[model samples]
Target: MESSSNFTPFLLFLSATLTVLSSVSANSEGDALYALKRSFSDPDNVLQSWDPTLVSPCTWFHVTCNQNNRVTRLDLGNSNLSGHLVPELEKLEHLQYLELYKNNIQGVIPPELGNLKNLVSLDLYNNNISGIIPPSLGNLKNLVFLRLNDNRLTGPIPKELVGPPNLKVVDVSNNDLCGTIPTTGPFEHIPLNNFENNPRLEGPELLGLVPYATNCS
Candidate 1:
């Protein structure tokens, strides 16, 4: 029964709210990426385009975004970068492909990376990374390829990795990993060579013959 003009103010308020939300989302994503830029030693200025003053990381080089301006991929492989990864990377909720392979990056793989539920491929091979494979990575139900070979990592591969239903490929060889290889799930079809070369890692376990925990001790 009221006049239609009365709705104008409410509609304007709603529009402004949405704009603010979009800006905040963009800025937060930018901040998270900028934090990473600060953590790395980029000799080639491959990250020169990562200006934190920008409205969105979508405009940055090596960063891919979806139609909604949400980060989807980060391709910084082989860029001569050397530094640890930042935990802030978990903020990219829509991230899928995280490729930082064949670099000189050191330090542990941030456990927070497991929070990226949409992640598909995680390639950190041929780096200087050293740490346990985070069990938290089991949360990535959408993961497909995970390559962490040729690093200095030392620990048993978390059994949780065996849970991702879509995981088709995994290579953790040439590390210092200790323990029997997981025989279930995606590992069942994976080539044995993919898990070889770790001096302490053993088994495609013989059921009832060699227990799964035989080597870790």
Candidate 2:
């Protein structure tokens, strides 16, 4: 009878251990989502519905998760969110789509965003962000679509972004940028509209014109 009593406590210990392990796994997912939530300062409470108490981000609005319960899509475009882009977003290892266009976010593009190796589409256009494009963004090897138009970003276009192998669409117009646009690879195929309004920018063909030739010289 005494031996049975000892075995009962052993079983209880095993059950408790399993429970703790399960809780840890659950909290880890919550922690990642929570970190992303905390990065943005939602002034109009657009993201107030993103509560940690929710069992999974999959059930949350505007957040799509894969079968494994990992967040893969974050589409919050035109949600009126106003804040700076946070480097903490790199924690979403499985994120594939991130859309936050038509907002008021303002700041330098965080180089750490390159850590999202699985990212395929990133759209942050029509914002107030101001900064030079980070060369580290060239590391998004899987990026297919990237848009950052109508912003306050300044400086020369990073040459590294000219011809990323997987890149198909890139828009960086209406910004305060300058320099001779690269004439190789993707740059050669992009239309004049893509680099318009940046008065200092000179394309290969444009450089031969009398007006452009004088400025470029």
Clashing pairs in 2: none
> After TM-score superposition, what is the CA distance of residue 184 in candidate 2 from its true location, in Å?
2.5
Cα RMSD (angstroms) for every candidate in the order listed: 1.6, 6.3
Residue ranges of candidate 2 with Cα displaced over 4 Å: 1-33, 204-217
List where candidate 1 sits over 4 angstroms from the true fold.
Answer: 1-3
Q: Would you estimate the TM-scores of all the predictions?
A: 0.94, 0.77
lDDT of 2 by residue, 1-217 (tens): 9999999999999999977765565456566667766877787777777778866666767888786677788898998877788776776777899899998888888888888888999898999999888877788888888898988887777777764677777788888776666655566666668777766666654543433223432
What lDDT does each candidate get?
A: 0.91, 0.76
Model 1 over residues 28-102: C-alpha lDDT tens digits?
Answer: 889999999999999999999999988999999999999889899999998999999999999999999999999
- List the lowest-lDDT window of 10 residues for candidate 2: 208-217
- Look at candidate 1 and tell me the lDDT of residue 103: 96
Decoy 1 TM-score against native = 0.94
